[model samples]
Target: MSGKSSLKDDIYAAVLDDIIEGIYKQNEIITEKQLIAKYGVSKSPIRDALIELCKEGVLISHPRYGYEVVRINEREIRDVVDFRILIETGCFRVAAPTFTKEDIEELKNFTLNECWWNGKDELPALKHWENNMRFHLKLISYSGNDYCYRMVENSTGLLTRAYAQRFWDQRDNRAWNIDIEGHLCIIRCMEEGRFDLAEQELKKDIASFLDIICPNYARAVDL
Candidate 1:
């Protein structure tokens, strides 16, 4: 990437992290100058990053107040998980029929390779999020439906927002342990050609996750 483009991406990640970490609350104003100083960069990259974030619905631009963080609501949180369930379960129904031992091995390797799912928060918060994304995206892709894959990618940001809020608010070992176990359970169900069982486990997993992340999700996303 060009230097300016790379800088823009860096600033974008940093700003997103700050917002996710509750460094800035919902509707909090963020100035270009503040970001420039914080990132030690020029206006061009900061502006680019903020504009992209605005487009992503993570932030909104205000003529009077620089930029404001998004306040995600309970409905939006439910919608993300509900939508994910719809897409993912459908994928599992189809994908499991063709699921192979090698596929299971590959996915197992992928999620467990750099993850801290054994005990607790041994994994960094961001790494845990990334690991979840990898598993979900791969699960959908195995269905051989490109559209399902893309839809999950597009809609997953809401969960990311919610997950980040919980992580920033509290890092619980139990949560991580359960999350990893849920993934493993689904994989095993798929391996056994028990697609129905896989779907049930997935629903249970999502419900458990939503319980911890929602209602309180606005605490991190809103003002």
Candidate 2:
């Protein structure tokens, strides 16, 4: 890649992470100068990165000054959880019966407490969000539905923003171990071939997360 392209990619990755980590609040303005300094790149890279984010709806463009971070409100939050609930609950219905013990174990591999923290033992919201995504995607993929996995994966941008917006400090204050426990419950139910219980646990876990992140977000996920 050209230097400019390389810089743009780096800036994009860094800024995207910040956006999804909720480090930059909604409607916040970020200037190229700030990013140029932050990423130690030229103005061109920063401009390109902002433009790219705007394309992804992660940022809104401003003429010459800077870009504005879009707000991910409770409605958006509700949509994400409800989406997960709908897909995941259905996934368990189909995937649970076919799941072997090995499948459950595979899903469990990522839910370890070690997955929640960074090398410094700090619980970063972005890292945890990634882990959460992996868990959900792994479960869906194991369900043997190609379309389902792709559908959920396509929501990564929006989902990451929603997660970062609320979960930035949640892991710091709350115990992510509880989240692992919830996943374990779902896995156990699936392994036991109790699809009903697995579905219930999956819904409850999504609802619980919604309650924590955005209580104003409608908690009901209609089947």
Candidate 3:
């Protein structure tokens, strides 16, 4: 990558991390001057990063004021959740039937691997989320469709940011443990060639976030 592009990407990630970590609250104004001073970079990469964030709907650009962090509404959250279900389970249906013994074993390792954590009870929310993404992406990869994989990847990333913003202070290890079980159940259904059942389990896994999104939006299975 070109040095300018690399700097832009790095600044983009740094700004995104700040947003996710609550350093930049919703609707907070961020100016290029502030980012330039903070990162000790020039205006070009700062503008590039801010422009990229604006394109992603993560920020709103004001002509003279600066960029404002976009506040995600409940409706937008539900839309993202539904989009994830459509791509992930849809891809799972196409992929599950083609999973080999090796594929199944590798998936099992995602949840069952001890190296990724000290123990389930002691797992960090960040690490648990990583495993969750790994399992879902791995299953989707078997579909052999690059576009579907990218869709799931991007949707999951948005959800991850939302998740951190909502549940950062409410770390419940038990809930994450339940999600791991959900992952295992989907894998079991895939192993048995029960594509329909596997899809249901995958939907439930994706819908687990509904608990955080809203009380009205319960699990997908209930809907």
Candidates' TM-scores? 0.80, 0.79, 0.85
Query: Which of the two, 2 or 3, has more lDDT?
Result: 3
- Most accurate candidate by lDDT: 3
lDDT of 3: 0.78
lDDT (Cα, 0-100) at 196 in candidate 2: 92
Candidate 1 root-mean-square deviation in Å? 4.6
Give the per-residue lDDT digits (tens) of candidate 1, residues 26-130: 667899988888777788999999999999999989976699888776778877878888888878787776878898888878767754446556766666677
Candidates ranked by TM-score, best first? 3, 1, 2
Error (Å) of candidate 2 at residue 149 is 1.8
Candidate lDDT (C-alpha), each: 0.76, 0.73, 0.78
lDDT of 3 at 171: 47
Clash pairs for candidate 2: none
Clashing pairs in 3: none
Q: Model 3 — TM-score against the truth?
A: 0.85
Q: Residues 142-184, candidate 3, lDDT per residue (tens digit)? A: 8899999898888876777766665543543335333577888
Error of 2 at 210 (Å): 1.3
